[model samples]
Target: MQALYDVPAPAKLNLFLHVIGKRPDGYHLLESIFALIDWADTLHFERRGDGLLQRHDSEGANLPPDDLCLRAARALQQASGCGFGADIHIDKRLPAGAGMGGGSSDAASTLLALNRLWGLDWSLQKLKELGLSLGADVPFFLGGTHAFVEGIGEILHPVTLPEQRFAVVKPAASIATKEIFSSSLLAMSKSVAIVAGFPAHNSSENKTVDVTRYLDGFGKNDLQKAAEAASDDVVQALELLETKFGNSRMTGSGSAVFARVVQENGKSDPAMATMLQEAIPAGWQGRICRSLEHHPLKGWARD
Candidate 1:
């Protein structure tokens, strides 16, 4: 294929996050359940025979000098010694610094697309190893399923979650991941055996486990406190969602918060979704998103 159009890079919600410990390299080891959501950014790729990578923002938004997409392309090119290159265009739907894994997802999709576009035929494991060099969350997007993530987000255990909906809101302001991690408010959470009960390791076993009760009460985003300390927008977003939905928590690092949209008799309530969307402030962004079973680009690369 000479070009791949309208590839999706979906955002994720950390159903719950806990900082378990710190690595010698200053990276925080974390445990979280990352759920792919329908909210996403769209990307397009066109092949280049001259082996020169380029990126374009479809919305004409300013992007970083060396964005993750370009980095991923370059990495793949170098690793495979492929003479082909790509011109990547991003739709820029997801917000930056919202802890939604937008950049990571974009990078992962670039890897998947270029792998096929350039005819490299690299295995999924090889792509994942390269993806980890770009960011911890990149591998999860490449994994293509809702997962129980650990070890700074590289280790993944795919799980099956019941279909659910969420009301997600992002404030006008953004919080730096560094700022949240550096805050004095950040603390290591006590280790728990949440993974022991999971059937993710065995494909033959039934993977559909109900963890709604755990999400509702047992787990919490450990980064929320630190993020709130760094940005008041985080606090406001949480309060706004909590007041509307009765329970809310900050996802990932912060500036975005979400609450589970309670289903009534196995169906989502449209009125609740409309009310939540209307309640968001003018400068902020909010969406009622349904969880995704797998990434749209799941089988792009060989397993």
Candidate 2:
């Protein structure tokens, strides 16, 4: 095929993030569950025989000149020694600096799409290895399912989570990942017995698991305190969601916080969206997002 259209690159929510320790290399060791959400960015790819990698963004998007999509495509080309090229267009939807892994997801999608567009037919493992070079979270996106992530975000253990909805909010302000991690307020948690507490359930199974039993009082984003201190908007977003939903937590790092939407009679509360729309302040973004069992492009690459 010469072109691939309407390929999706979904965002992720850090159901819970903990800073266990710091690696000698200055990377923080983390343990968290990265849950895919339906909120996504769309990408289109057209094969280019002229051996040139290009990226186009939606009008008024004003993306960075050297965004992850271009970086991912170049990296793949160099790694595979492929002479082919592609023109990638991004329909940007996810917010930046929301701690939602938007850019990483885009990069992962680019790699997966280019692999097919170029007919490289690379294995999933190969793509993931190349993906890690792009960013820590890129590998998780390539993993293609909700996963229990560890070890600076490279390790992935696919876990089954019951279908659920979340109320997600992103404030007008943004916080840098480095700023959150470098803050003195950042706290580290004692390494817990993740293997013992985290149940190992296959994502392929149709059975339901009571995720709340483990997540109810589980770990939190250790970076939230630092982020709140950095941006008053973070504090506002957290309070806004917590006040309305009865509980809220910052995902990944900061600026975006989410709360689990309680279902009524086995159906999502219809009023959740209205509540979010009214409660969130002007210039902020909110959505009622459903958890995904797997990424939309799952299995795009050979296993």
Candidate 3:
């Protein structure tokens, strides 16, 4: 009997990303609060009796033949030595290279869904070991919770943040992560500290050093300066968003900027989401998404 498996690969917002330092290996130490969004790409997997991995979606057609999805499936198969293979399908909704963690999320979904479909029954720790090989952000998506991430983005600790609204805008252009990281203009120095008692502790100290406050005070994305310097379209799009939303900042490396705009009551705002979506510039894509406290399909994983 072939069991059908479907899972969601949710996009993420780097509520804010700070490059604290660069490592000898060229990987940058980062401090970021990553929140999952409602917008997600769906992946479906079907087990094949024969031991051969296959993909059935066109979302990543133009990506290199050896994309993360295929690589993930192959890696899982190799590790488990499962006699069965999977035919994978992806419905890509998130934009590519917008710093939304699309590819990494897809890879994490592949590892998780296939584990159950093949009856691998691997523990979360084991799953993470395999997932990290796919990408730094893969483990966070696999962990399936809002997180405070650090150390080249592999170390993840769940953090409680108030449910919030974000107006996300992706420029027509895609800024390559590698280019931004390697750019000479990137800011590579920042101090490290745990953002304790985020939105819940609205005390004067908390208010002074809260994630939103830190972001508003710092006005930094190590990659943003480099990315904007590298492309004019990105700068134009970011400028327009900042003009509309006063608290606007780039989400990840480049090309996608987000504005934090929760309601007066500190609740999610559907109207704001609608307005943000409608207000996208002629050549850009935008959405108003709520920060997800938990992954939508977490119940499915229990099956």
**How high is each candidate's TM-score?**
0.92, 0.92, 0.86
RMSD of 2: 3.5
Q: Pick the winner on TM-score between candidates 1 and 3.
A: 1
Off by over 4 Å in 3: 58-63, 194-219, 264-274, 297-303
Q: How close is candidate 1 to the true structure, as a TM-score?
A: 0.92
Model 3 accuracy (lDDT, Cα): 0.76
* Candidate 2 global CA lDDT score: 0.86
lDDT of 3 at 100: 89
Give the local distance difference test score of model 1: 0.85
Give the CA lDDT, 0 to 100, for residue 218 in model 1.
61
Ranking by lDDT: 2, 1, 3
Q: Weakest 10 consecutive residues, lDDT, candidate 2? A: 200-209
TM-score, prediction 2: 0.92
Two-way lDDT contest, 1 vs 3, winner? 1
Residue runs of model 2 more than 4 Å from their true location after superposition: 199-212, 264-270
Taking the tens digit of each residue's C-alpha lDDT, what string does model 2 give over 139-218?
99998888877789887777678786899999999898998899999989865444464533222222222355666657
Q: Rank the candidates by TM-score, best first.
A: 2, 1, 3
